[model samples]
Target: MSIESGMIRWKNRVALVTGASVGIGEAICTSLVSHGMTVIGCARSKDKIDMLSNDLSKKGLSGRLIAYKCDVSNDKNIDDMFEWIAKNHGGVDVMVNNAGFSCKDTLLEITGDKMRDMLNVNVVGLVLCTSKAVKSMLTRGVDDGHIFNLNSMSGHRLTGILNFYAATKFAVTALTEGFRRELVENSKIRITAISPGLVETEFLARAFEDKDMAQSVFARCESVIKPQDIADILLFSLSSPPNIQIHDVLVRPCGEKI
Candidate 1:
């Protein structure tokens, strides 16, 4: 399919991306903006997103990037963010739930508070954002709106080191399908779950205290996916014709055993 030609329909439209300060989220924001779509990049730390916005603005692309401060773990923050979007720039046509992380603790050692925080961000936050985005599309009679959930390979299988995090992703897998089934009855809105393995990101360093060790783990891998790779996949999915609904996409680096 001609991704560029398909994206003509989305030119000047708005797309909201959570956890947009870095890694895959940041790459997605950049790709969307490059495709002539106004992108809202939201993160808990708005400074980085603001910096990115400035950089993109200087490029003078057809699209623009808006930096938004949002803590997806907090319901109030999420509600306020959506409200502001509605009031200022109309509702979102694309929703990307990419804000997710694993705690430093293993399942056996994780505290209740830490577990709750992970669930709030990974599961609850994603659900709430999807609901609001879909509602916005339906209220505005937007049949071609899309929703993307950033899942993981762990969602489809078990990983000993990240058991708890994998559980959350499994929830995402089910949610993506559930959303598609529910929305297909009333609208043509599409939902896609992107499951990726071993992307070069801060996720591992953050998950483990030792940054060097994280780097070493990636070094051992034959290949590691880049953030831009995932961004490209998302663009391809988004650029599909309205008649085509690209569902679940499971991607892994070449030679990745698991």
Candidate 2:
């Protein structure tokens, strides 16, 4: 590779990706390692994390793959995960807050339990991870840090179904913008949000046990997006030059409409 092109590779940078046990988060972790970045993957599933760590070790392509079992909803676990990373990896330069949950429910018909779970996982999880990550960022004395939150297409112009999920994602987008402004003013932290249309992963399986409703959401779009597609975009956001800060990214397969 030419020097110009090689300079763009994230071979030495350190990054933390949450919700990396499966789906887009896993794809992002895999791609980051391939590009030479030291990727720290966090997920609540110990089994999946162990499998990924071992799998990547066999590939011999992984530079530094540290998989940690973390429950983002828990305060102690979140702090411990960040503390471990800081002790071993010298804090992260980029953090991807991809930990979230999805379940279909109408806004009016949504149960108290469902709403609380959604808020705890999606909104609360983001805030908790960001708080912990910011601590490491401050301790490392990193003048510049980047954060990316996985918002959804629903966060933008919500003109379709998935009302319950839409509300949570809108919260994400709002929180991202709010944090972006605050971080920019108070610190050198940069924030970006990505809203993906439809992705083909086990996310649907885990999210929707109901075959009928899952199929309904699946039918809204034509072709399902591959995890790699979102992963590539994520890498781009993280690897972009200092002056070029990506505010937001909208990724969708063809035929996906409002």
Candidate 3:
């Protein structure tokens, strides 16, 4: 019902967020930690996560933030990270699959190796992480656990430049539903897809390999989605009553046409 009512249910819970070094992932970790949740932020760049942890400490956060080095694309890394979470925190009650990327190359120009790398990180990595989270929840008998996948507008509709990235997101969309169907029948676990359009993040800079172009894309728009905005939406979804499931959420800026 109310946002506060829903959020109260998650206080002191354990949450694991991928790609927590920056952008949406970082925002989610910050918000959850503020809400008295123990958050484990995982990323390939442990230094960035460590920096965020230190910043949160200075702010006198109500909860804790722990940084772990993890490259989701690597199975060994995922295994080790999940194992550490299990051993240290018992298990995760929330999982945010927010690590993803796109390259500047088009489908025609993209190299085989690059394409495979994208698939490995975007699809395989997400699936593996989801499996691990679900298994942990089951083993711990934590039926009310929630998993959120950071999808995109490209997942729902085809965009010329983002076709390849869209393909990976579309796979995520499918997996979200598939997991929901399979899990709800037996467990109370919840799965959600938070799809946003044109977020102001490092995603564009990395995608284009040009800072100016990324800034220009947002500069021309009247408004662009902010990482905190997505984090808020995620908090809302996670706050819902155990009986309710917020399956899909699509967000965009006020003036965003697509």
Best by TM-score: 1
Q: Which sections of candidate 3 miss by over 4 Å? A: none
Model 1 off-target regions past 4 Å?
none
Candidate 3 lDDT by residue in tens digits, 9-58 = 78888999999999999999999998889999998888988988999999
Residue range 69-96, candidate 1, lDDT tens digits: 9999999999999999999889999999
Report the CA-based lDDT of candidate 2 relative to the real structure.
0.79
lDDT of 2 by residue, 50-144 (tens): 68778887898746677888888787888888888878888888789888877756676779989888888788889888867776787778757
Give candidate 3's error at residue 33 in angstroms: 0.3
Task: Find the 10 residues in a row with the least total lDDT in model 1.
Answer: 103-112
Model 2 deviation from the true structure expressed as Cα RMSD, one decimal place: 2.6
User: In terms of TM-score, how similar is model 1 to the real structure?
Assistant: 0.98
Better of 1 and 3 by TM-score: 1
For model 2 the local lDDT of residue 81 reads 83
TM-score of 3: 0.98
Record all residue pairs in model 1 with backbone atoms less than 3 Å apart, i.e. clashing. none
Stronger candidate by TM-score (2 vs 3):
3
